[model samples]
Target: MKKITLVFLLIILATTSAQALSWAYPFVVWSGNVYEVTTEEVKNSVISKRIGEVKTKPNDTTGNYYGNASNEYPKGTQYFAISDISTDTAIAVRVKKEKYVKAVFVHKASSHWNPYYYFILFVVAVVLFSLLGKKRFH
Candidate 1:
């Protein structure tokens, strides 16, 4: 029984560590839109330009348009629009990067899954196993 528990813990640790190491491409939020670097070149260029930005806001169900019916740019706002030359996708916008908006601006989808949740679960499992092991030994 002890060996089985030890093996299970090792397996969980290994799998969790592997999952933690896996990297996902980050989504950039700008001008009420979510953009992802579609190519390695664009990723490198954006990093070099220091233009990567992200913002978190309440989920808006309306749409992806920059603004409402008025469609007026905010006062004293300087917009730097970055677009993918090939696909014509808007990548990022400099200035007016509000931190209260979700990254993706699709119709019904929310933000991506957060990896921290998995980490937290792993920690909880480790603690539970340690407690069980101690109780069993005693």
Candidate 2:
């Protein structure tokens, strides 16, 4: 029983570590205080349109839009925007919250993309690469 417990504990630790290491790039769009989603997936995200009226809090997940939806989005998110093909007007925004996931994944402009996490990886790679280069000359 002790052995089994130890193995289970190790597995749990590994799983949690993996999840934390794999941070996602979350992206979001909003129009009139509501997330601009669409009935279909919008491959081309919109850019530079009247942002409407943004009153989002610093890290709050909740937002509202002036537009209204019946049964489609009783919660008030516009799904049609996410399905946009020409997605030129799709505004790109990022909020650190799990509730705001449309397709479960999107390349967001978040702090993860910043030069932070992979900085160590980059240095290690460069050192290994340089050592390999020396082998060729030898």
Candidate 3:
């Protein structure tokens, strides 16, 4: 029974880790601002108007031209699709749109792994092991 419980716990942990790695949010960086597509409604409603084709160099990290070390738009500026005209700055633009850029290279928000969660898990395992060991010895 103890072995079965341990196996089940291991399975749960594996599933959680897999889910954490696979999930990702989609976003677009335009005019030095990041916009995250939260729902299907926003993704469908928001459309980027093509101004003109501009050559862009890929960044070192993401290998994307839009957001590199410079953090500026490409040389040739074309499209200007304003979802919210109220914002004066890029940071404000993110706040206004309710989509903030977590990382420039990825151009998306990544869920951070909290160490406390693992610490709690470890404590629980230790407690469970102590309890089980005591039972087995008695």
Candidate 4:
């Protein structure tokens, strides 16, 4: 039973961590402001420039963009942003540590997760086992 429960938890964490982040490779997006950060930390980001709307030819596909960064990135640039950033449109940033292109689903809002849901499920499991009784009924 303990092994089953442990496995279940590992599976949940694995899936959530995997699905939550599309790419964990170290990358940087500076509002172009100077800042210091580690792979997990971001700071001192500045808005370099917001993409302005322009006339597009037919079959043009684009979204609201507000920032820019070189895909290859220049030296002395931060690798990842520790500060929160939002834009009307999501822009793809370059990851220096990674080989291919990747994206992060930046939310303009916060997220909510119910902790009680897990507690309730745990209670249900306990109740079911108690009702079933121990083997040999001892």
Q: Pick the candidate with the highest TM-score.
A: 1
Candidate 1 backbone clash number: 5
Candidate models: Cα lDDT each: 0.38, 0.35, 0.40, 0.35
Off by over 4 Å in 2: 17-32, 39-138
Candidate 1 residue-wise lDDT at 19: 22
**Cα error of candidate 1 at position 91, Å:** 17
User: lDDT rank, highest first?
Assistant: 3, 1, 2, 4
lDDT of 1 by residue, 21-123 (tens): 2224434444334444333322323311233333232223432222211122233322233333411344333333431211223332334434466799999
What's the candidate order when arranged by decreasing TM-score?
1, 3, 2, 4
Score candidate 1 by TM-score against the native.
0.28
Clashing residue pairs for model 4: 27-79, 28-79, 31-46, 31-47, 42-81, 42-82
lDDT of 2 by residue, 35-123 (tens): 33433332334322322223222222222112221112223232332334223434332222212223222223222122343698899
Residue-level lDDT for 108 in candidate 2: 33
lDDT of 1 at 83: 38
Looking at candidate 2, what is the lDDT of residue 116? Answer: 42
Each prediction's TM-score versus the true structure: 0.28, 0.20, 0.26, 0.19
lDDT of 4 by residue, 1-138 (tens): 999999999998888432222332333233422121123322224323323221111111221122332223443332232224443223323234332122243333222223456799999999889877875487
Please give, for residues 4-74, the per-residue lDDT of candidate 3 as tens digits. Answer: 99999999888843221222443344444444333323231343333232234334344343431123334
